[model samples]
Target: MKHEMGRSDLLRRIQEVEFVALDINLYLDTHPDNMEALMDYNKYVYELDQLKRTYEMNYGPLLNFGFSPSQYPWRWIEEPWPWEI
Candidate 1:
């Protein structure tokens, strides 16, 4: 993330984190006593949020709720959708 990454790269990282979290979540469902797995799940979820915010700030809302009042008009609509990239 230190180096400038393309939009797709950031998107991919977000997916990677989510994927990790999803697996951990499934494991925790069966092994509810695994505190370590719970911690990891929280970590990945946090990372995913950070990445999504960063992407949305520079690009636009990833979801309808991602809008953060902007001084420059509602330019979120101008940005190309993720798949359009």
Candidate 2:
């Protein structure tokens, strides 16, 4: 299912996965014994993590700080601001 994804598409996929995880999280809050939901949640979370890693590698930090490492004098600052583009 993997293909060349632009930044916007990748961001959309990441958000979609996280939203699914969040809904599952709410379901689990009331039914903590649901192993099936738990497994689904875990799968989505792992996919989200991989997406984030891919995003960071190709397009700077998805976050404003913290998750991004100081690889080369904070190149994130040089990336085009979302509002500017």
Candidate 3:
């Protein structure tokens, strides 16, 4: 099923992704030989990429491309900050 997540929900998802990514990174540090954890980490990375792309497309770019604007360039411009929801 498809989800029609709002901006706040999307941000929350991104935060979850960040936590999962960090957790996976720490897991890999200790269990570097575990193929299952590595696979899961790869999957999480892919999901994070998708989330970031969706966010950027709707809200403006988040990271710097070689020829693009730097990440967080307009950090002060207020939209709905994450806590507003």
Q: In TM-score terms, which candidate is top? A: 2
In order of listing, the candidates' clash counts read 0, 0, 0
lDDT of predicted model 1: 0.77
Candidate 1: worst 10 consecutive residues by lDDT?
63-72
| Candidate 2 C-alpha RMSD relative to the actual structure | 2.2
Q: What TM-score quantifies how close candidate 1 is to the native fold? A: 0.78
In model 2, the clashing pairs are none
The models' CA-based lDDT, in order, is 0.77, 0.79, 0.71
> Could you tell me the lDDT of residue 2 within candidate 3?
32
- For candidate 2, write residues 1-85 as lDDT tens digits: 4737988888888889989999999999999999999999999999988887887777777667576654466766866743344
TM-score of each: 0.78, 0.84, 0.72
Q: Candidates sorted by lDDT, descending order?
A: 2, 1, 3
> Highest lDDT: which candidate?
2
What is the alpha-carbon lDDT for the whole of candidate 2?
0.79
